[model samples]
Target: MSVRIGFIGVGGIAQSHLSGLLTLPEAEIVALCDISRQQVEKAVERFNKEAVGKEPAGRKLEAAIYDDYRQMLRREKLEAVFICLPPFVHGEVEEAVIEASLPFLVEKPVALSLSLAGKILDGVLKKELITTVGYQLRCGSFMDKARAALAGKTVAAIVANRFGRTPGVSWYHRQDKSGGQLVEQATHQVDMLRYLVGEVDTVYAAAATRINNKDNPEYDIFDSNCMTMTFACGAVGNFGNGTMAHVGVPPGLNGVHIFGDNVQVTIGGNLRIATPDGVTEEPLDKDMMVRQDSAFLKAVAENDPTLIRSDYLSGVRTLAVTLAGEKSARTGQPVKVADLLAAEAPAAL
Candidate 1:
């Protein structure tokens, strides 16, 4: 059974999701909605070219574009949707999707305001929807080996980093819009940490706009941040993130290193493992984004939430951790995730 997919935002990330979704035989990219009609038109052009040899029989790559998602939600016979809007613009579309009882795969970080996130989460709970967040970094075979290797072992600590270039988008340069690199770009690493280690309980961070702000006067978000975290499993973690990087930064340096009993696992260009005897390397054997897209569509087709690895609530928790880091950076004190959620979330949430 093909899932009739509609996209809420046709930005760069949404286009990436579209690439993976096109690979699935059971996916039909039927409609698109974006605030910019030109962007949606460009997406349609790309889809027409890329989907020609891929679409199933009797299915054409005809995605009707719309500016208002509510109109798209009402007019289209969509089975699932991809909500790829920015962090600040998340609440209404998600709530409407849940109200319509349509399953969706939303990109992270889920929201900038926890209150709005809580409300949307509450609606998703009441509707019992199948949702996945776009934490595509944790979806490939290297990660599979890492998970299997740590199945029974207790993870003692994790050292992660996301030292990379600033995104080439206007909204991304502002802290109020994208929640800085920590909440916008590095949320991928943060989600991977939560997925591999455990749930975070508290966080303390120090951050500043060191270099990128000087280069671009409009840029206000921090380019350098270092955070300390405590997990529910009594594990400790250190996260370092910066957006001042140029082209020379090695890809392996921006990933994570996890430590446990006689085990040291590094997840970067590949999965590297050391267990007292020797060190071994495992390359990322597959395209992770495709795997993530396949998982979401498969789960939606089967109506089984169990197949989904990361759901909406899990995304919310990850958002809390990143937002707490932002708060901690401002206050110069440790921030508890629970307290942050409780203060911002509604009663039902």
Candidate 2:
């Protein structure tokens, strides 16, 4: 029997997951919901065309569309759900999903508000639902090698940077909406830093709006961010990102590097490791997002939660770490992640 799925948001990120789910024979996307009904319809048309010859013979895509997610949740007999909403619009959808006792996969930087995220995490834990986050990089084959390379070795520091053009999406330019590049885009690195090194204890950051805002007057998010972090295990990290590049000009440099006891790891388009003994390189064999989708579907089918790497709590922690940096940048003082997570109380859900 195929695992039935419903999507709560049908935006660009949702389509990324949709592309992966369309390849699986056991996955069936039964419903899609978004504020714009037409957006859902268009996504259906796009993916259905891609599903040609992939589905069972003569099985037409009849996925229902909706502008209201609550109605879709009540009406559909879904086995699982994918909440692919933006940073600012996550809490309510997740609460409803948990209330319905359905397993779900939510995209990362889970929510802009830490209190709400913590509340959702608490509810999820109470229900013991199988949940996964969209940090697909963790599903990469190259990541396996990176983890293996660090076995028994301590990671001392992680240094990473990302330079790119402003995303075409309008919400990304608003700090209140997207929380700048650190919270929105470079969050994958923050999550990976935690996965590989350790939990960040403190964050100090500085940022400026150099260029993007000048051209796009309404742009409120900073174009550049530089951050420093101290980890629970005494490891450290320096990460920076900027959104000032031209559309056609490539940043020419992006990725993370880890330094440790006799080990150096580089993760970019591929994975590279150097030790006193030798150097190893691993290239990804498939799309990590697709792999993540496959793993989540399997977890749902078999009721096995261990198959997922980044669970809901992990996503919440990552959001806290990134938001701590944002707060530090604004205040010019180091922000402890624990302090940030503790200051917020769960709002009425």
Worst 10 residues of 2 by lDDT: 340-349
lDDT for every model? 0.86, 0.86
The 10 consecutive residues of candidate 1 with the worst lDDT sum are 51-60
TM-score of 1: 0.94
> Where does candidate 1 stray beyond 4 Å?
51-60, 346-349
lDDT of 1 by residue, 67-172 (tens): 9999999999999999999888888888889988999999998899788888888888888899999887777778778877777788899999889888877799
Compared with the true structure, what per-residue lDDT tens digits does model 2 show for residues 253-309?
578899999999988766889999999777755789988888988998999999999
- Decoy 2 TM-score against native: 0.94
Q: What's the residue-level lDDT of 239 in candidate 2? A: 94
